[model samples]
Target: MPNPWDLPDELPTDLPVSRCELPDGRVLSAVQEAEAHTLWEEISSAAPYRKAAEGLRPGEAVIDVGAHIGLASLLFGGLAPESRVLAFEPAPKAYTCLEDNLARLLPGATAFRQALGAASGTSELTYRPYVASASTLYDDAEDDARNLEAHLDNIGADERTREVVRRTFNVSQRVTVEVTTLASVMAEHDVDRVGLLKIDVERGELDVLDGIDPACWPRIRRVLLEVHDIDGRLGRVVSRLSGLGFHATVSQWGVYVGGSVHLVLAERD
Candidate 1:
Protein backbone atom coordinates (compact mmCIF):
# COMPACT_ATOMS: atom_id res chain seq x y z
CA MET A 1 0.00 0.00 0.00
CA PRO A 2 1.04 3.60 -0.63
CA ASN A 3 2.20 5.63 2.40
CA PRO A 4 0.81 9.05 1.53
CA TRP A 5 0.55 9.90 5.21
CA ASP A 6 4.33 9.69 5.48
CA LEU A 7 5.20 11.54 2.25
CA PRO A 8 1.89 13.41 1.55
CA ASP A 9 2.10 13.35 -2.26
CA GLU A 10 -1.65 12.67 -2.66
CA LEU A 11 -2.95 15.11 -0.01
CA PRO A 12 -4.79 18.26 -0.98
CA THR A 13 -2.67 21.38 -1.45
CA ASP A 14 -5.39 23.95 -0.80
CA LEU A 15 -6.05 22.85 2.76
CA PRO A 16 -3.41 23.09 5.47
CA VAL A 17 -2.07 19.71 6.59
CA SER A 18 -0.92 18.88 10.10
CA ARG A 19 0.85 15.69 11.13
CA CYS A 20 1.45 14.30 14.62
CA GLU A 21 3.95 11.60 15.45
CA LEU A 22 2.39 9.11 17.87
CA PRO A 23 4.35 7.65 20.79
CA ASP A 24 4.52 4.46 18.75
CA GLY A 25 6.32 6.47 16.04
CA ARG A 26 3.35 6.39 13.67
CA VAL A 27 2.52 9.64 11.87
CA LEU A 28 -1.16 10.67 11.51
CA SER A 29 -2.50 13.48 9.39
CA ALA A 30 -5.13 16.11 10.27
CA VAL A 31 -6.21 19.60 9.31
CA GLN A 32 -4.98 21.28 12.51
CA GLU A 33 -1.76 20.49 14.36
CA ALA A 34 -3.05 21.32 17.85
CA GLU A 35 -6.21 19.29 17.30
CA ALA A 36 -4.13 16.41 15.98
CA HIS A 37 -2.02 16.41 19.14
CA THR A 38 -5.08 16.62 21.34
CA LEU A 39 -6.78 13.74 19.49
CA TRP A 40 -3.67 11.55 19.77
CA GLU A 41 -3.39 12.30 23.47
CA GLU A 42 -7.06 11.46 24.03
CA ILE A 43 -7.38 8.44 21.75
CA SER A 44 -3.93 6.84 22.13
CA SER A 45 -2.45 8.18 25.37
CA ALA A 46 -5.57 8.49 27.50
CA ALA A 47 -7.28 5.55 25.77
CA PRO A 48 -10.91 6.21 26.66
CA TYR A 49 -12.09 3.43 24.35
CA ARG A 50 -9.59 0.89 25.72
CA LYS A 51 -12.01 -0.86 28.05
CA ALA A 52 -14.85 -1.07 25.53
CA ALA A 53 -12.51 -2.15 22.77
CA GLU A 54 -11.04 -4.94 24.92
CA GLY A 55 -14.13 -7.06 24.23
CA LEU A 56 -13.55 -7.05 20.49
CA ARG A 57 -13.55 -10.52 18.90
CA PRO A 58 -11.65 -11.55 15.82
CA GLY A 59 -13.41 -10.56 12.55
CA GLU A 60 -15.84 -8.29 14.41
CA ALA A 61 -16.27 -4.66 13.35
CA VAL A 62 -15.45 -1.42 15.18
CA ILE A 63 -17.69 1.41 14.04
CA ASP A 64 -16.45 4.97 14.46
CA VAL A 65 -19.09 7.68 14.12
CA GLY A 66 -17.64 11.17 13.84
CA ALA A 67 -14.20 9.66 13.27
CA HIS A 68 -12.76 13.10 12.40
CA ILE A 69 -9.34 12.45 10.87
CA GLY A 70 -9.22 8.74 11.85
CA LEU A 71 -7.19 9.06 15.08
CA ALA A 72 -9.74 7.10 17.13
CA SER A 73 -10.10 4.51 14.36
CA LEU A 74 -6.34 4.12 14.29
CA LEU A 75 -6.34 3.53 18.03
CA PHE A 76 -9.13 0.97 17.73
CA GLY A 77 -7.24 -0.81 14.95
CA GLY A 78 -4.17 -0.97 17.21
CA LEU A 79 -6.15 -2.18 20.21
CA ALA A 80 -7.91 -4.87 18.17
CA PRO A 81 -5.80 -5.66 15.16
CA GLU A 82 -7.90 -8.69 14.22
CA SER A 83 -11.05 -6.60 13.94
CA ARG A 84 -12.15 -4.41 11.02
CA VAL A 85 -12.72 -0.63 11.10
CA LEU A 86 -15.58 1.38 9.57
CA ALA A 87 -15.39 5.16 9.99
CA PHE A 88 -17.99 7.89 9.22
CA GLU A 89 -17.08 11.54 8.74
CA PRO A 90 -19.33 14.15 7.10
CA ALA A 91 -17.21 17.24 6.67
CA PRO A 92 -15.41 17.36 3.34
CA LYS A 93 -11.99 18.36 4.60
CA ALA A 94 -12.08 16.15 7.63
CA TYR A 95 -13.43 13.22 5.61
CA THR A 96 -10.69 13.71 3.05
CA CYS A 97 -8.04 13.58 5.73
CA LEU A 98 -9.79 10.65 7.39
CA GLU A 99 -10.02 8.69 4.14
CA ASP A 100 -6.36 9.35 3.41
CA ASN A 101 -5.16 8.46 6.90
CA LEU A 102 -7.14 5.24 7.00
CA ALA A 103 -6.13 4.26 3.47
CA ARG A 104 -2.42 4.66 4.19
CA LEU A 105 -2.31 3.61 7.84
CA LEU A 106 -5.16 1.10 7.91
CA PRO A 107 -5.34 -0.40 4.44
CA GLY A 108 -8.65 -2.28 4.71
CA ALA A 109 -10.59 0.19 6.84
CA THR A 110 -13.68 1.72 5.19
CA ALA A 111 -14.44 5.45 5.33
CA PHE A 112 -17.89 6.93 4.65
CA ARG A 113 -18.40 10.57 3.74
CA GLN A 114 -21.82 10.87 5.35
CA ALA A 115 -23.37 11.74 8.67
CA LEU A 116 -25.32 9.23 10.73
CA GLY A 117 -28.61 10.42 12.12
CA ALA A 118 -32.13 9.39 13.17
CA ALA A 119 -33.27 9.17 9.56
CA SER A 120 -31.60 8.78 6.20
CA GLY A 121 -31.73 11.91 4.08
CA THR A 122 -29.90 15.13 3.25
CA SER A 123 -29.07 17.56 6.04
CA GLU A 124 -27.17 20.77 6.54
CA LEU A 125 -23.93 20.24 8.37
CA THR A 126 -22.07 23.03 10.07
CA TYR A 127 -18.44 22.77 9.04
CA ARG A 128 -15.81 24.67 10.98
CA PRO A 129 -12.72 24.84 8.83
CA TYR A 130 -10.53 26.17 11.64
CA VAL A 131 -11.83 23.71 14.22
CA ALA A 132 -12.73 20.80 12.00
CA SER A 133 -13.46 18.42 14.84
CA ALA A 134 -16.17 20.70 16.22
CA SER A 135 -18.19 20.57 13.00
CA THR A 136 -21.60 18.98 13.48
CA LEU A 137 -25.15 18.50 12.21
CA TYR A 138 -26.52 20.39 15.20
CA ASP A 139 -25.42 23.98 14.67
CA ASP A 140 -26.16 25.83 17.87
CA ALA A 141 -23.66 28.66 17.72
CA GLU A 142 -24.41 30.33 21.06
CA ASP A 143 -24.59 27.12 23.04
CA ASP A 144 -21.50 25.74 21.35
CA ALA A 145 -19.53 28.92 22.08
CA ARG A 146 -20.61 28.90 25.70
CA ASN A 147 -19.78 25.25 26.14
CA LEU A 148 -16.35 25.73 24.55
CA GLU A 149 -15.65 28.72 26.77
CA ALA A 150 -16.53 26.71 29.85
CA HIS A 151 -14.37 23.82 28.71
CA LEU A 152 -11.44 26.16 28.10
CA ASP A 153 -11.90 27.73 31.53
CA ASN A 154 -12.02 24.31 33.13
CA ILE A 155 -8.72 23.40 31.44
CA GLY A 156 -7.20 26.78 32.40
CA ALA A 157 -6.25 27.58 28.83
CA ASP A 158 -4.29 30.77 28.25
CA GLU A 159 -6.14 33.85 26.96
CA ARG A 160 -4.42 33.61 23.59
CA THR A 161 -5.48 30.01 23.23
CA ARG A 162 -9.00 30.89 24.35
CA GLU A 163 -9.23 33.67 21.77
CA VAL A 164 -8.04 31.39 19.01
CA VAL A 165 -10.58 28.72 19.91
CA ARG A 166 -13.37 31.29 20.15
CA ARG A 167 -12.54 32.53 16.67
CA THR A 168 -12.51 29.02 15.29
CA PHE A 169 -16.06 28.36 16.43
CA ASN A 170 -17.25 31.83 15.46
CA VAL A 171 -16.92 31.30 11.74
CA SER A 172 -18.46 28.28 10.00
CA GLN A 173 -19.86 27.25 6.64
CA ARG A 174 -23.01 25.26 6.11
CA VAL A 175 -22.83 22.39 3.64
CA THR A 176 -25.40 19.89 2.43
CA VAL A 177 -24.37 16.30 3.10
CA GLU A 178 -25.90 12.86 2.78
CA VAL A 179 -27.21 11.42 6.06
CA THR A 180 -27.92 7.76 6.90
CA THR A 181 -28.91 5.66 9.85
CA LEU A 182 -26.63 3.27 11.73
CA ALA A 183 -28.98 0.37 11.08
CA SER A 184 -28.77 1.01 7.35
CA VAL A 185 -25.00 1.02 7.47
CA MET A 186 -24.86 -2.22 9.41
CA ALA A 187 -27.22 -3.99 7.04
CA GLU A 188 -25.42 -2.70 3.97
CA HIS A 189 -22.03 -3.78 5.24
CA ASP A 190 -23.40 -7.11 6.55
CA VAL A 191 -21.80 -6.41 9.92
CA ASP A 192 -23.25 -9.16 12.07
CA ARG A 193 -21.62 -7.98 15.28
CA VAL A 194 -20.24 -4.64 16.39
CA GLY A 195 -17.44 -5.06 18.87
CA LEU A 196 -17.32 -1.38 19.73
CA LEU A 197 -19.38 1.58 18.60
CA LYS A 198 -17.54 4.83 19.31
CA ILE A 199 -19.46 8.06 18.75
CA ASP A 200 -18.25 11.66 19.09
CA VAL A 201 -20.68 13.69 17.00
CA GLU A 202 -20.41 17.01 18.84
CA ARG A 203 -23.96 17.65 20.23
CA GLY A 204 -25.81 15.23 17.97
CA GLU A 205 -24.93 12.13 19.97
CA LEU A 206 -28.54 11.45 20.89
CA ASP A 207 -29.67 11.55 17.29
CA VAL A 208 -27.01 9.03 16.35
CA LEU A 209 -28.21 6.69 19.05
CA ASP A 210 -31.80 7.11 17.95
CA GLY A 211 -30.77 6.08 14.47
CA ILE A 212 -29.84 2.58 15.57
CA ASP A 213 -32.65 0.11 15.00
CA PRO A 214 -33.97 -1.79 17.98
CA ALA A 215 -32.95 -5.06 16.31
CA CYS A 216 -29.39 -3.82 15.89
CA TRP A 217 -29.03 -2.95 19.58
CA PRO A 218 -28.36 -6.59 20.43
CA ARG A 219 -25.54 -6.67 17.89
CA ILE A 220 -23.62 -3.82 19.53
CA ARG A 221 -21.48 -5.25 22.30
CA ARG A 222 -20.12 -1.92 23.59
CA VAL A 223 -20.61 1.78 23.02
CA LEU A 224 -18.42 4.69 24.02
CA LEU A 225 -19.69 8.18 23.30
CA GLU A 226 -19.09 11.80 24.25
CA VAL A 227 -22.42 13.35 25.21
CA HIS A 228 -23.15 17.04 25.61
CA ASP A 229 -25.62 16.90 28.51
CA ILE A 230 -27.94 19.65 27.43
CA ASP A 231 -31.73 19.57 28.05
CA GLY A 232 -31.59 16.29 29.97
CA ARG A 233 -30.06 14.43 27.04
CA LEU A 234 -27.65 12.52 29.26
CA GLY A 235 -30.43 11.07 31.38
CA ARG A 236 -32.46 10.15 28.32
CA VAL A 237 -29.52 8.42 26.65
CA VAL A 238 -28.73 6.45 29.80
CA SER A 239 -32.33 5.36 30.18
CA ARG A 240 -32.59 4.36 26.54
CA LEU A 241 -29.40 2.32 26.64
CA SER A 242 -30.35 0.73 29.93
CA GLY A 243 -33.68 -0.27 28.48
CA LEU A 244 -31.81 -1.82 25.60
CA GLY A 245 -29.86 -4.01 28.05
CA PHE A 246 -26.72 -1.94 28.37
CA HIS A 247 -24.97 -1.02 31.61
CA ALA A 248 -24.01 2.60 31.10
CA THR A 249 -21.58 4.68 33.11
CA VAL A 250 -21.00 8.40 32.85
CA SER A 251 -17.84 10.35 33.80
CA GLN A 252 -16.38 13.76 33.20
CA TRP A 253 -12.74 14.55 32.47
CA GLY A 254 -10.97 17.66 33.76
CA VAL A 255 -11.06 19.26 30.33
CA TYR A 256 -14.87 19.13 30.37
CA VAL A 257 -15.59 19.84 34.04
CA GLY A 258 -17.10 23.32 33.63
CA GLY A 259 -18.91 22.22 30.50
CA SER A 260 -21.82 19.82 30.10
CA VAL A 261 -19.79 17.39 28.03
CA HIS A 262 -19.27 13.88 29.41
CA LEU A 263 -18.14 10.40 28.43
CA VAL A 264 -20.63 7.54 28.53
CA LEU A 265 -19.37 3.98 28.41
CA ALA A 266 -22.00 1.34 27.75
CA GLU A 267 -21.59 -2.41 27.71
CA ARG A 268 -24.15 -5.11 26.98
CA ASP A 269 -25.61 -6.62 30.10
Candidate 2:
Protein backbone atom coordinates (compact mmCIF):
# COMPACT_ATOMS: atom_id res chain seq x y z
CA MET A 1 0.00 0.00 0.00
CA PRO A 2 1.33 3.38 -0.97
CA ASN A 3 1.43 6.16 1.60
CA PRO A 4 -1.30 8.69 0.71
CA TRP A 5 0.90 11.49 2.00
CA ASP A 6 3.34 10.97 -0.86
CA LEU A 7 0.96 12.54 -3.38
CA PRO A 8 2.09 13.65 -6.80
CA ASP A 9 3.84 16.99 -6.72
CA GLU A 10 2.40 18.25 -9.99
CA LEU A 11 -1.29 18.87 -9.55
CA PRO A 12 -3.25 19.99 -12.59
CA THR A 13 -2.62 23.70 -12.74
CA ASP A 14 -5.58 24.44 -15.00
CA LEU A 15 -8.16 22.96 -12.68
CA PRO A 16 -10.47 25.64 -11.30
CA VAL A 17 -10.91 25.32 -7.54
CA SER A 18 -13.53 27.34 -5.72
CA ARG A 19 -13.46 28.04 -2.01
CA CYS A 20 -16.74 28.04 -0.08
CA GLU A 21 -17.12 29.52 3.40
CA LEU A 22 -19.68 27.75 5.49
CA PRO A 23 -21.99 29.56 7.91
CA ASP A 24 -19.92 28.11 10.75
CA GLY A 25 -16.85 29.92 9.33
CA ARG A 26 -15.05 26.84 7.98
CA VAL A 27 -13.80 27.09 4.42
CA LEU A 28 -13.92 24.24 1.89
CA SER A 29 -12.40 23.86 -1.55
CA ALA A 30 -14.47 22.53 -4.41
CA VAL A 31 -14.53 22.54 -8.21
CA GLN A 32 -18.12 23.66 -8.59
CA GLU A 33 -19.96 26.22 -6.48
CA ALA A 34 -23.40 24.66 -6.65
CA GLU A 35 -22.12 21.17 -5.89
CA ALA A 36 -20.16 22.42 -2.92
CA HIS A 37 -23.12 24.28 -1.49
CA THR A 38 -25.38 21.29 -1.95
CA LEU A 39 -22.88 18.96 -0.29
CA TRP A 40 -22.48 21.29 2.65
CA GLU A 41 -26.24 21.55 3.03
CA GLU A 42 -26.68 17.77 3.04
CA ILE A 43 -23.57 16.58 4.89
CA SER A 44 -23.30 19.43 7.39
CA SER A 45 -26.63 21.17 7.76
CA ALA A 46 -28.96 18.25 7.14
CA ALA A 47 -26.50 15.78 8.72
CA PRO A 48 -28.00 12.68 7.14
CA TYR A 49 -25.16 10.55 8.45
CA ARG A 50 -25.65 11.71 12.04
CA LYS A 51 -27.44 8.59 13.20
CA ALA A 52 -24.71 6.32 11.92
CA ALA A 53 -22.05 8.54 13.47
CA GLU A 54 -23.47 8.12 16.95
CA GLY A 55 -21.38 6.15 19.44
CA LEU A 56 -18.21 6.86 17.49
CA ARG A 57 -15.53 6.41 20.13
CA PRO A 58 -12.13 7.99 20.33
CA GLY A 59 -9.42 6.37 18.20
CA GLU A 60 -12.00 4.56 16.10
CA ALA A 61 -11.85 4.58 12.27
CA VAL A 62 -14.33 5.94 9.70
CA ILE A 63 -13.85 4.89 6.08
CA ASP A 64 -15.48 7.31 3.62
CA VAL A 65 -15.70 5.81 0.15
CA GLY A 66 -16.27 8.24 -2.69
CA ALA A 67 -15.44 11.16 -0.46
CA HIS A 68 -15.99 13.87 -3.08
CA ILE A 69 -14.30 16.82 -1.32
CA GLY A 70 -14.12 15.86 2.38
CA LEU A 71 -17.30 17.58 3.65
CA ALA A 72 -18.53 14.36 5.26
CA SER A 73 -15.02 13.58 6.36
CA LEU A 74 -14.90 16.95 8.09
CA LEU A 75 -18.19 16.16 9.82
CA PHE A 76 -16.86 12.85 11.11
CA GLY A 77 -13.60 14.45 12.23
CA GLY A 78 -15.54 17.10 14.16
CA LEU A 79 -17.85 14.48 15.67
CA ALA A 80 -14.94 12.39 16.97
CA PRO A 81 -11.69 14.32 17.18
CA GLU A 82 -9.37 11.43 17.98
CA SER A 83 -10.96 9.08 15.46
CA ARG A 84 -9.07 8.38 12.25
CA VAL A 85 -10.77 9.28 8.96
CA LEU A 86 -9.70 7.38 5.85
CA ALA A 87 -11.27 9.00 2.80
CA PHE A 88 -11.13 7.39 -0.66
CA GLU A 89 -11.72 9.48 -3.78
CA PRO A 90 -10.76 8.48 -7.31
CA ALA A 91 -11.38 11.70 -9.22
CA PRO A 92 -8.14 13.59 -9.70
CA LYS A 93 -9.43 17.12 -9.15
CA ALA A 94 -11.72 16.05 -6.33
CA TYR A 95 -8.92 14.10 -4.65
CA THR A 96 -6.70 17.17 -4.75
CA CYS A 97 -9.40 19.22 -3.04
CA LEU A 98 -10.04 16.44 -0.56
CA GLU A 99 -6.36 16.20 0.32
CA ASP A 100 -6.05 19.94 0.79
CA ASN A 101 -9.21 20.19 2.93
CA LEU A 102 -8.18 17.30 5.17
CA ALA A 103 -4.67 18.70 5.56
CA ARG A 104 -5.97 22.08 6.70
CA LEU A 105 -9.09 20.99 8.63
CA LEU A 106 -8.40 17.44 9.77
CA PRO A 107 -4.63 17.06 9.94
CA GLY A 108 -4.83 13.54 11.36
CA ALA A 109 -7.00 12.29 8.52
CA THR A 110 -5.73 10.27 5.50
CA ALA A 111 -6.97 10.76 1.93
CA PHE A 112 -6.51 8.04 -0.68
CA ARG A 113 -6.64 8.86 -4.40
CA GLN A 114 -8.13 5.54 -5.38
CA ALA A 115 -11.48 3.88 -5.79
CA LEU A 116 -12.66 0.84 -3.83
CA GLY A 117 -14.31 -1.83 -5.95
CA ALA A 118 -14.73 -5.57 -6.22
CA ALA A 119 -11.12 -5.98 -7.27
CA SER A 120 -7.71 -4.36 -7.29
CA GLY A 121 -6.86 -2.91 -10.68
CA THR A 122 -7.28 0.14 -12.82
CA SER A 123 -10.53 1.40 -14.35
CA GLU A 124 -11.96 4.39 -16.12
CA LEU A 125 -14.01 6.75 -13.94
CA THR A 126 -16.51 9.13 -15.41
CA TYR A 127 -15.79 12.45 -13.73
CA ARG A 128 -18.12 15.42 -14.00
CA PRO A 129 -16.04 18.43 -13.04
CA TYR A 130 -19.04 20.70 -12.79
CA VAL A 131 -20.93 18.20 -10.63
CA ALA A 132 -18.01 16.50 -8.94
CA SER A 133 -20.07 14.66 -6.35
CA ALA A 134 -21.91 12.71 -9.05
CA SER A 135 -18.73 11.29 -10.63
CA THR A 136 -18.54 7.53 -10.54
CA LEU A 137 -17.10 4.41 -12.17
CA TYR A 138 -20.63 3.40 -13.08
CA ASP A 139 -21.76 6.23 -15.27
CA ASP A 140 -25.41 6.62 -16.21
CA ALA A 141 -25.77 10.12 -17.55
CA GLU A 142 -29.39 9.85 -18.67
CA ASP A 143 -30.65 8.28 -15.46
CA ASP A 144 -28.65 10.73 -13.41
CA ALA A 145 -30.13 13.64 -15.28
CA ARG A 146 -33.63 12.32 -14.79
CA ASN A 147 -33.10 11.79 -11.09
CA LEU A 148 -31.66 15.25 -10.68
CA GLU A 149 -34.61 16.81 -12.45
CA ALA A 150 -37.05 14.87 -10.34
CA HIS A 151 -35.27 15.73 -7.12
CA LEU A 152 -35.19 19.41 -8.00
CA ASP A 153 -38.89 19.39 -8.83
CA ASN A 154 -39.67 17.54 -5.62
CA ILE A 155 -37.81 20.17 -3.61
CA GLY A 156 -39.39 23.00 -5.65
CA ALA A 157 -36.13 24.42 -6.95
CA ASP A 158 -36.51 27.50 -9.13
CA GLU A 159 -36.04 27.41 -12.89
CA ARG A 160 -32.65 29.09 -12.73
CA THR A 161 -31.44 26.60 -10.16
CA ARG A 162 -32.65 23.72 -12.28
CA GLU A 163 -30.81 25.08 -15.31
CA VAL A 164 -27.62 25.40 -13.32
CA VAL A 165 -27.80 21.77 -12.24
CA ARG A 166 -28.67 20.67 -15.79
CA ARG A 167 -25.52 22.29 -17.13
CA THR A 168 -23.34 20.58 -14.54
CA PHE A 169 -24.10 17.14 -15.97
CA ASN A 170 -23.79 18.17 -19.61
CA VAL A 171 -20.06 17.60 -19.88
CA SER A 172 -17.82 14.91 -18.37
CA GLN A 173 -14.46 13.30 -18.94
CA ARG A 174 -13.23 9.81 -18.29
CA VAL A 175 -10.03 9.33 -16.32
CA THR A 176 -8.24 6.10 -15.61
CA VAL A 177 -7.69 5.50 -11.90
CA GLU A 178 -6.37 2.88 -9.54
CA VAL A 179 -8.92 0.63 -7.89
CA THR A 180 -8.54 -1.63 -4.84
CA THR A 181 -10.70 -3.69 -2.56
CA LEU A 182 -11.65 -2.70 0.99
CA ALA A 183 -10.17 -5.90 2.42
CA SER A 184 -6.82 -5.07 0.87
CA VAL A 185 -6.92 -1.57 2.31
CA MET A 186 -7.73 -2.82 5.80
CA ALA A 187 -4.96 -5.41 5.67
CA GLU A 188 -2.43 -2.89 4.40
CA HIS A 189 -3.36 -0.32 7.03
CA ASP A 190 -3.94 -2.92 9.75
CA VAL A 191 -7.45 -1.64 10.51
CA ASP A 192 -8.83 -4.10 13.06
CA ARG A 193 -12.26 -2.50 13.40
CA VAL A 194 -14.22 0.14 11.53
CA GLY A 195 -16.57 2.38 13.48
CA LEU A 196 -18.44 3.36 10.32
CA LEU A 197 -18.17 2.69 6.60
CA LYS A 198 -19.87 5.53 4.71
CA ILE A 199 -20.18 4.98 0.97
CA ASP A 200 -21.83 7.23 -1.63
CA VAL A 201 -20.41 6.06 -4.94
CA GLU A 202 -23.33 7.03 -7.13
CA ARG A 203 -24.57 3.69 -8.50
CA GLY A 204 -21.53 1.69 -7.43
CA GLU A 205 -22.68 0.97 -3.91
CA LEU A 206 -22.94 -2.79 -4.33
CA ASP A 207 -19.56 -3.03 -6.01
CA VAL A 208 -18.04 -1.24 -3.06
CA LEU A 209 -19.69 -3.70 -0.72
CA ASP A 210 -18.44 -6.60 -2.82
CA GLY A 211 -14.89 -5.35 -2.38
CA ILE A 212 -15.01 -6.27 1.26
CA ASP A 213 -13.71 -9.77 1.76
CA PRO A 214 -15.89 -12.11 3.79
CA ALA A 215 -13.42 -12.06 6.65
CA CYS A 216 -13.61 -8.27 6.93
CA TRP A 217 -17.40 -8.08 7.15
CA PRO A 218 -17.54 -8.56 10.90
CA ARG A 219 -14.97 -5.85 11.45
CA ILE A 220 -17.28 -3.15 10.11
CA ARG A 221 -19.63 -2.02 12.88
CA ARG A 222 -21.88 0.21 10.77
CA VAL A 223 -22.57 0.75 7.06
CA LEU A 224 -24.26 3.79 5.56
CA LEU A 225 -24.60 4.17 1.81
CA GLU A 226 -26.71 5.74 -0.90
CA VAL A 227 -28.32 2.98 -2.90
CA HIS A 228 -29.70 3.49 -6.40
CA ASP A 229 -32.53 1.03 -6.59
CA ILE A 230 -31.77 -0.12 -10.08
CA ASP A 231 -33.09 -3.60 -10.81
CA GLY A 232 -33.22 -5.31 -7.41
CA ARG A 233 -30.09 -3.71 -5.95
CA LEU A 234 -31.73 -2.35 -2.82
CA GLY A 235 -33.15 -5.66 -1.82
CA ARG A 236 -29.96 -7.51 -2.71
CA VAL A 237 -27.89 -5.17 -0.59
CA VAL A 238 -30.27 -5.58 2.34
CA SER A 239 -30.08 -9.36 1.99
CA ARG A 240 -26.32 -9.35 1.77
CA LEU A 241 -26.05 -7.31 4.95
CA SER A 242 -28.58 -9.48 6.68
CA GLY A 243 -26.56 -12.53 5.77
CA LEU A 244 -23.52 -10.87 7.34
CA GLY A 245 -25.37 -10.47 10.65
CA PHE A 246 -26.30 -6.86 10.11
CA HIS A 247 -29.76 -5.35 10.56
CA ALA A 248 -30.32 -3.00 7.62
CA THR A 249 -32.88 -0.18 7.44
CA VAL A 250 -33.77 1.64 4.25
CA SER A 251 -35.25 5.10 3.96
CA GLN A 252 -35.56 7.90 1.43
CA TRP A 253 -35.61 11.61 1.96
CA GLY A 254 -38.77 13.38 0.80
CA VAL A 255 -36.87 15.05 -2.02
CA TYR A 256 -35.90 11.69 -3.46
CA VAL A 257 -39.27 9.99 -3.09
CA GLY A 258 -39.91 9.68 -6.83
CA GLY A 259 -36.31 8.96 -7.69
CA SER A 260 -34.38 5.71 -7.45
CA VAL A 261 -32.07 6.91 -4.70
CA HIS A 262 -32.43 5.62 -1.14
CA LEU A 263 -30.27 5.60 1.96
CA VAL A 264 -29.47 2.41 3.80
CA LEU A 265 -28.13 2.16 7.32
CA ALA A 266 -26.85 -1.19 8.49
CA GLU A 267 -25.69 -1.96 12.00
CA ARG A 268 -24.25 -5.18 13.29
CA ASP A 269 -26.69 -7.37 15.12
Against the reference, the lDDT scores of all candidates come to 0.85, 0.86
For 1-269, candidate 1 gives per-residue lDDT tens digits of: 75422433333324577677777787777888778887678666555577877858998999999999998998889888999999999999899889999998998999999999999999998887767898889977666866888888878889777765666556677899999999999999999999999999998898898899889988999999999888899999899889889999998777777777889999887
Report RMSD for candidate 1. 6.8
Model 1 clash pairs are none
* Displacement of the residue 218 alpha carbon in candidate 2, Å: 1.2
Which 10 consecutive positions of candidate 1 have the poorest summed lDDT?
A: 4-13
For candidate 2, the per-residue lDDT at 63 reads: 97
How high is the lDDT of residue 3 in model 2? 28
The RMSD (Cα, Å) of candidate 2 is: 7.9
Residue 101 CA displacement from its true place in model 1, Å = 0.8
Over 4 Å off, model 1: 1-14
